[model samples]
Each structure stands twice: as C-alpha cells, then as structure tokens.
Target: MHKIEELKIWKKSIKLTMLVYQLITALPSNEKYGLISQIKRSSVSIPSNIAEGAGRNSNKEFKHFLSIANGSAYELHTQLILTIELGLISKEKVQPVLDLITEVQKMNYSFQKSLETKISILNTQS
Candidate 1:
C-alpha cells in the first residue's frame, strides 16, 4: 500500500482544511449549521478520501477514492464562492484557500491519471 502521509496532495488537503476552519471563524454564527458546516465537511473529505484510497488494495480503488476527493474539492470551491458572494467572507481572504483547493484538485487529477496508466499497464501485462 502507498503511504498516504507521504503524498503531497494529502498534505496540501490537510493544510487547506485547516485554513478553511480558520476562515469560517470569521463567518457569522447563524451560518454555523449552513455554510460553515458544508465548507468544513468538504474540506475534510479531500484528505480523508485520499488516505482511505491509499489504504486500499487496488489501483482502481485508489483512483475511485481520488475521484471522490476531487469532487469534494470542487464542492468546497463552490461553497467558498457562495460564501464570498453572500458577503460572509471577503474575496481577498477566501482567494488563498480557493487557490490551494485548485492546486489540490490539479494534483488529484494528475495522480488519478498516473494511476490509470499504471492500471492499464498492469492489465496489459496480465
């Protein structure tokens, strides 16, 4: 199995999750059950999925989890944009987190593609 902690994408996702937590603190308390919860959940999902995927036995399973993580990253991106549009947080403050999410998303995509190629090669050999 691969080491989840050794993955750069997982590390970045953890950092992004922490940053999201910090950002949400500035949001109004009424949103605690709304945007705050949504953002937090999506942010955490990225790394959680990556770690879970890495623990799996097959590359296909790993790729599936990575795809899920990528989806969460996109979900987080949308929530962040909604938060800014609602004036819950300023674009200036949210931009960095958004950028990090984007980076993680790209990394996840590349990683998934690499896994697909590896799987294809393995299948061909078999």
Candidate 2:
C-alpha cells in the first residue's frame, strides 16, 4: 500500500486544512455554523479523501478518491472566495491558504493523470 503521509499532495492538503482552521478562528462567532462549518469540512475532506484513496487496493479506486478530493478542493476554493466577499477575513490573511490550495489542486490533477496512465498500461497488457 502507498504511504499517504508521504504524498506531497496529502502533505499540502494538510497544511491547507490547518491554515483554514487558523483563519476561521478570526471570523465572527455568528459564522460558527455557517460558512465556517462548510469551509472547515471541505478543507478537511481534501486530505482525508487522499488518505482514504491511498489505502485502496486498485489504481482506479485511488484515482476515484482523488477526484472526490479534487472536488472538495474546488468547493473549499469557492467558500474561500465567498468568505472574502462576505468580509469575514482579509484577502492578505487568506492569500497563503488560497495559494496552497491552488498548489494542491495542481498536484492532485497531475497525480490523477499519472494514475490514469498506469491504469491504461495495465489494461493494454491484459
């Protein structure tokens, strides 16, 4: 089985999750169950899905989970934009996390493509 912790995308997603939590703390208490909750869940899903996918036995399964994680990344990205628009946090404070999310998205996309290639090769050989 692959080591999820060793994956660069996993590590970066973890970092993004951490930054999201930190940033959320500064938001108003009224948002505790609103944008705050949604943001936190989506942020956490990115890494959690990656780890879960890594534990799967097949490349196809892993790739499927990566797609889910990618979706969560986009969801989080949208929520982050909403937070900025709502004035929950300053752009400067959230920029680093946004940047990290973009990096994770790119890495996830590349990794998924690599897995697809591997799967295609296996299919051809069979």
Candidate 3:
C-alpha cells in the first residue's frame, strides 16, 4: 500500500521517461553513447528508483529511494541543459523537458517529506 505506484509522482515519472526516450532517439548518431545514453539512464532511473523505494517495508527506506530518484531528476535536468547548450536540442524542446524535471523534483520532494513524517510518527510511537 505504500508503493509509489499509487502516487501521482510515479505516474508522471513514467510519462516523463517515455517522453525522454522519444526525444533522445531523435538525437544525432554522434551522441548515441554520450548525451543519448546519459539522458536515458537518468530518465529511467527516476521511475525505477521511485518504484524500488516504494517496495521497501519502512518509511525511511522509501524516503531513501525517493531521494535517489530526486538525484536522478537533477541529473536529467543537467543533461537537458547540456543538450540545449550543445545545440543538440532546440530551446523550445528544452523548456518542456525542464518543466517535467521541475514537476518530478517537486513530487519526489513531497514523497520524501511524507515518508519522513511517517517515520517520525512511528519513531515516537515506539
């Protein structure tokens, strides 16, 4: 029941990952193992870590995973910035991805805070 599968964050992460993949595929062949690979890894990690964290038995564990997911989101954001800077992707394309990154970051932080509160409550109860 504590799984992120039930979370709006997880849902949006899934959508964002798909979009990231699609965008990367359009990248030039020269970036295949560079920007493209990094983008894919960072994008996929967001949702993967979120789900992994959700599967943990404790709120602390879940929060740890969400933290990892947040890191991945930041990593993805950096890659987006680089892509724009390198002229691989246009400024317009950059904004939407950046927007999604912002949203994911907020969601991950919210999930982490919620988990922290739950852990605190449990700690107080024991």
Clashes per candidate, residues 3 or more apart or on different chains: 0, 0, 0
lDDT of 2 by residue, 34-94 (tens): 9999999999999999999999999999999999999999999999888899888899988
lDDT measured at residue 54 in model 3 versus the true structure, 0 to 100: 77
Q: Candidates' lDDT values, in order?
A: 0.95, 0.93, 0.87
Q: Which candidate, 2 or 3, would have the higher lDDT against the true structure?
A: 2
TM-score of 3: 0.95
User: Which pairs of residues clash in candidate 1, taking residues 3 or more apart in a chain or in different chains?
Assistant: none
State which candidate, 1 or 3, has the greater lDDT: 1
Q: Compute the lDDT of residue 94 as modeled in candidate 3.
A: 71
Residue 113 CA displacement from its true place in model 3, Å: 0.9
Query: Which segments of candidate 2 are over 4 A away from where they belong?
Result: none
lDDT of 2 at 3: 98
**Number of the candidate with higher TM-score, 1 or 2:** 1
- Relative to the true structure, candidate 1 has a C-alpha RMSD (angstroms) of 0.5
lDDT of 3 by residue, 34-109 (tens): 8888999999999998898778887788888889899999999999889889888887867887898899899788
What ranges in model 1 sit over 4 Å off? none
